[model samples]
Target: MDPYIRIEHLTRTYVRGTNEIHALNDVSVEIADGEFVALMGPSGSGKTTLLNIVAGIDHATSGAVSIGDQDVLAMSDARKAAWRTRNVGYVFQFYNLMPMLTAYENVELPLLVLPLTRAQRREHAQAALEAVSILTRRDHYPKQLSGGEQQRVAIARAIVTDAKVLVADEPTGNLDAESEQEIMTLLKRLNKELGKTMLMVTHDSAAAAFADRTIRLEKGRLNTKTPETAGA
Candidate 1:
């Protein structure tokens, strides 16, 4: 099968004064459809940078990134934005839910970009919330729910668009251990049952265990680590 995501000689550099910082260097990888992959590394290892590039939130200084068959790096900004809305879902470390909006409303926000009517958006949002098993908290505000509940709502919002790929950055970073387990379980379900391609950046080893493959990076280069059991 064709890879769902592909990167070729990807390099991202940031110029600070006379110094150039390479966030990624000649990095190339592929993620198959429905694959659960974890990006693991120390701080400033370029894991998040890779995620942003793949999600089209940021561009690489050199090289190419292709999602399925479309060359993401080659698209115009406007086209990239539209493609992201239709094909990518993002989950952040901090639940980026709008404080003023209720859980249901937050999930419905992404659908606004689509041609769907308000009623259709509501149905999709509600279904997403239900899929995450958080429909009961739909009427609650972010602050009104527990940390786990809030993250669940965020996941629901991410999936509301039915994006083919889900990119999560430290999704369990802010939750307690119990809540972390809950979030991991939900992500695992999304990959296994829903067949959503998932690429996650996480610091927690237990959390990385949920993925099928784990990749470690160091100083912007893919670290050479012997493959071990997922949780080992």
Candidate 2:
């Protein structure tokens, strides 16, 4: 079968003062429909850059990225934005929650751009919070929650749109050990049970152990030395 997500000859270069910096260099990879893959490497290895490109938040200097039937690189800016809103869920190292909004309100933010009714939005957001085990704190503001709880809210917000692909950048970086385990378990469950293809960038080997496989990068290039792994 064709890859559910395919990135071919991806290269990202940016001019920094008088020199050019290569963030990703001729990288190519394919992810299966429901596979959970972890990206690991030292700093400046292009893991986040690859995820950003895949999520449509940034364009590759030269390459092609296809998610399922859609050609991500081929879309116009507006079209790509719409597609990304509907298909990609992004989780960052820091929980990027609105300080003032309640958890439910934050989760509902993405739905505002869609055509859903308020009730529909409520249903989606509520389901997402419940999935992340944060439903009871739906009315709480970000500052009122613990770091783990806040991250849960962020995950809920990401999945509220029922996105097919989840791109997480160091999702457990800001949490304690126990919280990190909890979050990784939740992510594994989401991928296995809900069939969300996941691409997670994590420096923690223990965290990467939860994924079905691990891909490592070095100096913006694919390392070609990934170790076989299984979901915990």
Candidate 3:
């Protein structure tokens, strides 16, 4: 079967003054449908850059990216934004929830861009919160919630649109050890029960262990020296 996400000779470059920086260098990868894959690397390893490119928040300097049946790099900026709204759910490291909005309101933010009625938005937002087991805390603001709880709310916001792909960048980075474990367990359940394609970028080996396989990047290049193991 074809891979759900296919990246072909992907390269991203940046020019500042006279210096040229390569964030991604001819990197190619394939992720299967419903597969939970983790991306691991050190600082400045092009991890976030790759994630943003795939999520349509950033443009690649070259190469191609196809998520599911769509050629992502081929889409116009407007089309990419629309595609991202429908197909991708991005979970940030810091749990980017609004300070003023309640959890339910934060989850509902993404849906406001769609054509759905308020009732439909409510149903979807509620379902997403339930999925993350955060329904009970829906009325709490970000400042009122614990780090783990806030992360759960962020996850709910990510999936409120029912996006097929969940892209998480250090989802557990900001939490304590126990909370990190809780968040990882929640992510695992999301992958297993919801069958969402998970692409998580994390430096923590324990976090990567929760994934089905691990893809390591080093200095903008894939590390093939180490054998792929189960987090294979």
User: Residue 176 deviation, candidate 2, in Å?
Assistant: 0.5
What local lDDT does model 1 show for residue 38?
92
Per-residue lDDT over 171-203 for candidate 1, one digit per residue giving the tens place of the 0 to 100 score: 999999999999999999998898999999999
lDDT of 2: 0.93
Per-residue lDDT for 60-101 in model 3, tens only? 999999999999999999999999998999999999898999
lDDT of 2 by residue, 57-146 (tens): 899999899999999999999999899989999999999999989999999999999999999999999999999999999999999999
| TM-score of each predicted structure versus truth | 0.97, 0.97, 0.98
- Candidate 3 achieves a global lDDT of 0.93
For candidate 2, the clash count comes to 0
Angstrom error at residue 183, model 2:
0.4
Clashes of each: 0, 0, 3
In model 1, which range of ten residues has the least summed lDDT? 223-232
Model 3, C-alpha of 146: deviation from truth (Å):
0.4
